[model samples]
Target: MSFDQLASELVSRKRADLYRERRVLESPQQPEVVVDGKAYLAFCSNDYLGLANHPDLIRAFQQAADEYGVGGGASHLVSGHSFHHHALEEELADFTGRPRALLFSNGYMANMGTVNALVGKQDAVFEDRLNHASLLDAGLLSGARFQRYLHNSPESLAQKLEKTEARRKLVVTDGVFSMDGDVADMPAICHTAKVNDAWVMVDDAHGFGCIGATGAGVAEHYGLSVDDLPVLMGTLGKAFGTSGAFVAGSETLIETLIQQARTYIYTTSMPPAVAAATRASLKLVIAEQWRRELLKSLIQRFRDGCQQLGLTLMDSPTPIQPILIGDSAKAMTMSAALREQGIFITAIRPPTVPQGSARLRVTLSAAHSEAQVDRLLDALERVK
Candidate 1:
């Protein structure tokens, strides 16, 4: 708790090779980026659809800014809500096939607020072991009896659910595991939760705008309806290539959050221009099916090339492909070696991932060409 203890802990992290730092990105999120005066073929961005710097989105943002100014200026309940924000929420609700939707400043606040609003001391919350940090923290902050099931194990979840005697039960999981890049077995989880009379919540932050026919995310990918996955959370920042988050569900569910979610009620709303830009991005996400196709092709190409080189990869059909290197030091060394070859891939170490499972988190974007992917494969071949 003391400053001296914090310094000692920082030193310990540095010694263990578990310390994390940020790279100064000199350019926008793209396949090729300038970092600290050096250019690199980057594979670490989450702009899966390559819409982060899209001209249309920029234009939409600019137009909205010209009309509405730069800031929300207040929280949603305090007159910060604009026509742009309302329209975006309506569009999201329609796109997700939900009756209503509510926007939050970011995904972290959305997750925290949603979970906290739904459960309390007399309730029980069960989460997958690999759920996002925000989900875990929300569960703890809810004052619920929180328990974690084995990762992606429906049977484990069922066993835990059967034992909970709380007044309300909530089962939460990430639709796509961020570090592992594997989709959750939502059908099984939903079935188990349904039988146990527990509500299911999915934070499909990474899955949205990258999965499904119209990029409706994991629920749509699995053909799940609103009844099956009642509480759904998606972020605009990742594949949508904007900056905000939303929870889409029943009208009652949204109204309940509007009344009870502290994070949404207390924090200032996101910029109206961001909402306008996201509206533009959402249109592209729905109409431009080719972006998703290109991303899938890139993912397959990268996986095939890595397999041919005998590099270990996680079971991921998505854009996030992690090359497993057991030791943290080895992962860092491989990342540095790739950087020397003008490739920019980040080494993900504990406690992001489990101990002894440090990896190079190589992400793919639609903006990257096949030749660029080949270049990355070639660099990875050398580094590995």
Candidate 2:
């Protein structure tokens, strides 16, 4: 089995500017980071609330590590479900305004597990055309009848929902679409789904810790309850500034997942220390309103600056602002150019984005000062 064809395919991707490489991160996640042995003002992090390196979260993790040790040791069904994990799930349930919440190792697993647990061959899944890869993969893996509607178009969703004759129909979407940074019209979607007798699930990975008044995420922003959005999923890594992911919903829904979701039942639970740190992170997420407020301000500041530069921006009110570059090779060049100027924003190209829509994915954070944003704007002016 010579991998000659595989090697040729890799070469083709590189020539087409589609090859992806991992940059070595040598420091903790923050506005300023050491990557590939050089310090850069990083603008591509998902740490929207800037709590990833918060002193309190760090201290809590260290303290918990002393008590619970490092690894999860076993699956949640075995000895790995520690006190911290149990407590965090309770806190998450309360935070999300759901009856119960179950934790998974990561967002991908959470999506895959929940979707598979809820629907099967006789059922169907409806999703946004622009859903995150995890949700799309989950729908495909569940062996359900999968269909995608136009992005954020509740009318399109309703049209599809009206025609599906599957046993169970689950409508899935991203609360805050990860790449474009635009939010889904959850109110309209929920209403349509309810009318059509379909279950609604929102993967709010980017919404948690960023949107909503008390950082309860998009559901809270829209005043939606468990009855409105039946399955709510969020990742701890983004706004919560830790790691792991969870699904919050009714007790029956959660227990169903616990029993049937192989991703959750068989995988090692997240480390108890991470659960402890996330508990601390959750406290900050709720108590520190100023963090979200600062994020709001920063997002506006960056957007305003981009507008002045006459740069094409997506309809995104979130911190994830993508500057449209359109050409994949040029987008890669622009990313490197910004890096040379000590500003780090990654070029997101196809198939992460559709063809002819390559972009410089500029993510803002509360940790960034207005001055740093200005520096990026200045660099963008030079590059563009």
- Go through the candidates in order and give the C-alpha RMSD of each one to the true structure: 0.9, 0.6
lDDT of 2 by residue, 1-384 (tens): 899999999999999999999999999999999999999999999999999999999999999999999999999998999999999999999998999999999999999999999999999999999999999999999999999999999999999999988999999999999999999999999999999999999999999988998988999999998999999999999988899999999999999999999999989999999999999999988889998888889889889998999999999999999999999999999999999999999999999999999999999999999899999999999999
lDDT (10s digit) by residue, model 1, range 79-137: 99999999999999999999999999999999999999999999999999999999999
State each model's CA lDDT, in order: 0.95, 0.95
- Report the lDDT of model 1 for residue 358: 98
The TM-score values for the models, in the order shown, are 0.99, 0.99
Local distance difference test, candidate 1: 0.95
Give lDDT for model 2.
0.95
> Model 2, residue 309: displacement in angstroms?
0.9
